[model samples]
Target: MDFKNSTENNEKVDANYNVVPLREAMCKTERRLRRKIDIFVVPTVMLMYLMCFIDRANIGNARLAGFEKDLKLKGYDYNTVLSIFYVGYILFEIPATMCCKIMGPGWFLPLATVGFGACSIATAFVKTRAQVCAVRFLLGIFEAGLMPGCAYYLSRWYRRAEYSFRLGIFFSTVPLSGAFGGLIASGILKLPHLGSLKGWQMIFAIEGIITVAIGLLAFVTMTDRPETARWLTEEQKELAINRVKSERLAQAVLLDRIDATKLKRGFTNPITLATSFIFFLGNVTVLGISFFLPTIIRTIYPSRTTIDQQLLTVPPYIVGALLLLLISGLSWRFDHRQAFIILTGPTVFAGYAIFLATINANIRYAAVFLSASTAFALGVMSNAQVAANVTSDSARNIALGTNAIFGYCGALLATWTYLPWDSPKYMLGNGINLACAATWTIVGIGAAAWMVYDNKKRDERQAAGMEEIVGLSQLEIQDLEFRHPAWRWKL
Candidate 1:
C-alpha cells in the first residue's frame, strides 16, 4: 500500500472519530489555533496602542510638573514642540503605513514601537525646548505607523462587520491612556531617589520602558497572516482567507493586487475626501480636549494643588472610556454606524457649548463629562464609517492614512488653537471645538444620507435585470458614475 494513501486513510479515521467532515475537522482545528492567535492580537495591539497614547500625552502631564518652568519655555514654545510631533507624524504616516503593507505588521509595527520607545526615553534627558522638540519629532516619526498599521492588521484577522467594534476597542485605549497616565503620574511623581529627575521625566522613563518591553513581546508573538498563523488548522486558515476575499470581491476590491489608479480614485472620491476632512475636524476636538482638559479643570478650581489637578484629569477620561465601550457595543450589535454618529455629534457640540457658557463649577464639570462621553462615541463612528466605506485594501489603507495625517494636522492646529492666551476660560478653544462639532454633525448627516440613497440605488439596479451587477465590490462600485451608468450620488 502507498504511504500517501495510508495517511489519507488516517485523516479519514480522524474525521470519523470527530464526527465531522474533513473541512469541518480542519475548521475546528483552525478555530482552536486562532483562539491562541487572538490572545496575542487583542492584548498586544491594545498594549501597543496604550503605550502610543501615553508617550504622546505624557507631555501634558509634564506641563503640570514644572517642565515649562525648568526649561524656561515661553511664547508658544511648548505648543511648537507639541505641534512638531504631528509634523513628523504627518510626514511619515503614509509612508510608514505603505511600508507595513510591504513589510508586514509583525516586523514593521514592533520596530516602530521600539524606535518610538527609545525616543520617548531619550526625552527624559532633553534640557531645552529645542531638544524636547527634536525628541518629540523623532517619536512621532516612529509612531506614525501605529493607527493605520493596526487598523490594516485587524482588517486581515476580522471581517468588515467586526472591524468597527474592534477598532473602537483598540482606539478606546486613547481615552483610557488619559486616565492611566494621570493615575500613573500621580503615583510616580511621589517616588524618591530618582535623582533630580522631575515627575514628567519619570513618567517618560517608566512609560517608555513599558513600551519597549511590549514591543519585544509583539516581535515574539505577532502573526503575519492566517497561513503563517501556527495556531490555526489548515481548514480554518482557508476560511479566514476566503471570508475576507469574498468581502473584498463584494466591494470590488482586488485582495492580492494594488491598483494605483483605483487607489488614486479613492483619494479624489468626494465621500472619501469629505470623510477625511471630517476626521481632521474631529481630531481638533479630540486632541484639544485630551491635552488641555487638565488645565481647564485646574482653572476651574485654581486653588487646588498640582496633584489634585492631576487626579481630577482621570474622571473625564474614565467617562470617555466607558461611553466609548458602550457605544461600540451598541454599534456592533446593531450594525448601525451612521445613525450613532449623527445622534452623538449634537451631544458633543452641546457639551462644548455648555462648558463655554457656564460659570458654575458643577455645570462646568458636568460639561467635561458630557464632552468626553459624546466625543468618544463620535470618534468610534468616524473611524468605523471611514473603514466601512472604502473598499480596496490599498485604497482603504491610503484613505485611513490620509485621514490620520489630516487628523494630526488638526491636532497640530489645536496645539496653538487652544492657547495659553485664552486659558482659565479657553474661550477661543471652546469656540473652535463648538465649530468642529457642528462641522462633524453636518458632514456625518451628509455621509449617512449618501449611504442610504446609494444603497437604495443598489437595490433598484438589482431589480432592473442586473443580476451580474448585484453586488459590485467596493473598488468596482467606487466610480459608479463611469462604471455603473445607473448609479447616482446617494445623498
Candidate 2:
C-alpha cells in the first residue's frame, strides 16, 4: 500500500484502491501531461493574475495621470487611501481563500476578479479622498482572495518540485502588468478628456472593463481539477493526480473535504508561520515598489514630460520580469527553494543600499532594476516553499492564505513608508526598505537552517526506531501531515 516502495514500471494499489504509478516509469507521459496542463491551466491563471495585478497596481499609474489632483487628496490623504485598502485585505484574506476551496477555484477566482474589477471601475467616479478610500477598501476585499487563491489553485495541479517555476510563470504577470500598465496608462493619458472622466479616470474605467471581460472568460476556461478537465484523458487525469500523490506525505489524496482539525493544523504549522513572515518582509519591498514606482519615476525625471515618465517605468519592470523567470526556473531545475531565497539577500540589500547612498539620478534609476529583480520573486518562492512543506489540500489553502495576510500587513506598512514629504530621494523610505531586506536575509537564513536541523533530527529519530512509520494506515499517517517521520522539508 506504500506507493513510495512500489516496483519500477508498476502501478501500486493504495489502501483506498487508487492505482498510483512509480514516478520513474511516467517520465515521458508526465512531460507531455505537464505541457498540456501548462497550456490549458497556466495560461488561464496567468491571464487572470495579469489582470488582477494590473487592476490592483494601476492606482500607481493613476496617481501619475493626476489621480490625486482630480480627487483633491491632500498631505497624508493619499497614503491613508492606500493604507485603507489593506484593512479590508488583511481582515478578509483567510476567509475568502477558504471560500476559494468550498466554492471551487473555477467559480471563486473569477467571481473575485469581477468583484474587484467592479470596484476598480467605481474608482473612476470618486470625487473625494473618502470616496477613493471606500472604493479601494472594497477593491481590497475583492482582491484579497486572488493571489492566495491562485497560489493554492496552482498547487492543486502541480507536483511539489514543479510548483516554484509554474508559480513563477503565473507571478511573471506581476511585472508584466507593471510594464504594460505603464505603457497603457501613458497612451491613455495622451487622449482628450472624455465626458466627465480625465486621463486618470479613463485609466481606471478601461482597465477595469478589460479585467471584467477576463473574469467572465475564466468561467469557461478554467476546470476545477484534473478529474473534470475535458481537455485531459482519463488516463492523463489519473496520471496527473497520482504523480502528485506520490510526492505527498504518506501518499495523501490531493483533495480532501475540509474540516476543523485540518484547518487548525494549517494555521498552526511552524513552516507556515516562518514562510509567511518572510513573505511579509518581502512584501514591504514588493508593494512599496509597486505602489510607488511611478512616483519614484516622476521624482527621477521631474523635468521630463508625464508621458516620458510613464515610459521610463517600463524598463525596470521588464528587467524584474526577466530576472524573476530566470531565478525561479533555476529553482525548479535545481529543485531548491530556500537556497535561492537566501541568495536573494545580497541582491536586495545592494539594491536598496544604492537607493539610499546615491543622489546621482542615473545611478538611483539603475538601482530600480536591481530592486525589481527580487521583489516579486520572493512571492513565488515563499508560496512554493510553504506549499511544499504542508501535506493536505485544506492545509495548503490555509497556509497560503495566512501567508497573504502577513504579506499584506507589510503592504500596509509600505503604503505609508513613502509620504509626500519624503519626496526626491526618499531617504526614510529607502532606509526602511533596506532594513526590511536585511531582516529578511536573517529570517531566510534562520528558516533554512531550522529546516536543515529538523530534517536531520527526523532522520535520526527514524534511524533509531523511535519514529517508525511502516505498516501504518493511510489516515493515521496522513493526519501527521508534515510531522510524519518519513516527511522531509524541501530545502
Candidate 3:
C-alpha cells in the first residue's frame, strides 16, 4: 500500500526480473506496442517535418522560376535573404525546443507548424527583397522548434537503441523534401499561370496551403506522451514508460519537471558539446547543398530547360534519402552510431573533392549523389548520439536543441557558400565543403575514441569502489542522471 516503497522495490525487482519466458513475452508485447507507436507517431511527425523542410527550402525552387528577377534582387541580395532565416533560427532554437518540452510536443509542434505555414503563404505575397527576408526570418522562428522537438519527443517513446532508426525515418524527410519539392516545383511550373500568380508564387502558395492543412491534422493525431496515448491499453502504457526508464540505469521515472540544473547539465555535457560540433560541421555541407543544389544543377546542365534542371536535383536527394534510411537501420541493428557517422565523413569528403576536381558535367553530377549520401544521415546520428548520452528528459531537450543551434550556425554560413561570382565551377564553395567533410571525419573519430576511453575510466573508477551511491534514495540516484556511475555511453 506504500507507493514510494513499491516504486523503489520495483527497480530492485526489474534488475532480477529477466527470466527467459518473461523476457520473451515482454519482447513480443513490446513489438506490438512499437508498431502502434510507429503507426500513430511516425507518419504524423514525418509529414510535419516534410512540410517544415519544403517550406524552408522552397526559396531555392523559387529562384529557378525567376524569383530574383521578379523581385529585382541584385548583387548579394539573394544570399542576404537566405542568411537572415538562420539568424532567427539560430537565436530561437534552444528556447523554442525548451518550450516544446514544457508545453508538450503535441501542442507545441502543431502550433509552430501553423505559424510557419502561414509565413510560407505570406511569402507568396512578398513583392520586394526586404519583405521576403522578413517573412523568411519569421518562418525560421516557427520552424526552429520542430526538428529538435520531434527528436526529443521520439526519445521519450523509444529506448536508446531504438531511437536512431525512428529519427532516421522522420529525418529522412530532409532529403525526401528535396526530391519531392523539386518534383512539385517542376509540376507546378509546367502548369499555366494560376490567375495572376507567377510560377514561383504558385510554388509558395500551394506548398504553404498543404503545410497548414497537415498542421491542422496533427493536432487531432499527436499524443503527448506514453501516459497520454489513448490508443494504448493500460498495460501497454505502463510497459512503454518502464522500458524507457529501465534503459536509463533503471531510473525512477520517465519524465522529470524542467529545472535549471538539468538545463545547465544539458548545455555543459561533454558528449553533447562534442556531437553538436560535429553536427555543426555536417550542416555546412547539408544546408549548403539544400540551399544551392538547384543552382549547381543549372551549372551542370547549362542548356537544359528549367524543368529539366529541377528534375535533375531529384536523384541526388533520392539517393540521400535511401542511404539515410539504410544507415539508420544498420545503426539500430548494430547499436552503434558514431562509427557510421565517422564513415559518412569520408564519403562526403570524396564527394566535395570530386566537385573541386571536375567541370566535367557527368562526373560532377555524380558527385552530387555522393555529397547527398551522408549529409542528411549525420543529422540522425548526431541527434540520436546526443539523446542517448544524456540521462534526463529536460537534459535531452536542451542537448538536442544545442545541437540544432550549432547546426543553424553552419546553415548561416552555407547561405554564402555558393556565391554567384563562383558560378559554373564553384571551387570556393566546393573547397569549403571539402574542408568541413575532412574536419568532420577527424572530429568524429576523436569523439568516438574519447567515448570508449571515458567508459573504460568510469569502469576503473567503479572497480575501485569510487562510485558509492549507498546513502542515496532511488529518486536521488536518478537525479544524478548521467553522472551516476551506472550510466555508460551508448557508443
Q: How many residue pairs clash per model?
A: 7, 0, 0
Candidate 2 Cα RMSD (Å): 3.7
> What lDDT tens digits, residue by residue, belong to model 3 across residues 181-204?
999999999888777887899999
Question: Distance (Å) between predicted and true CA of 183, model 2?
Answer: 0.5
lDDT, each prediction: 0.76, 0.86, 0.89
Worst 10 residues of 2 by lDDT: 1-10
Q: Residues 432-469, candidate 1: write the lDDT tens digits.
A: 98898898789888887776777676666755645556
What ranges in model 2 sit over 4 Å off?
Answer: 1-25, 463-474
Local error of candidate 2 at residue 345 (angstroms):
1.9
Q: How accurate is candidate 1 locally (lDDT)?
A: 0.76
The numbered model that scores best in lDDT is: 3
Q: Candidate 2 at residue 42, lDDT? A: 92
lDDT of 2 by residue, 42-114 (tens): 9988988998888888999988878888888889888898899999999899889989999999999999998
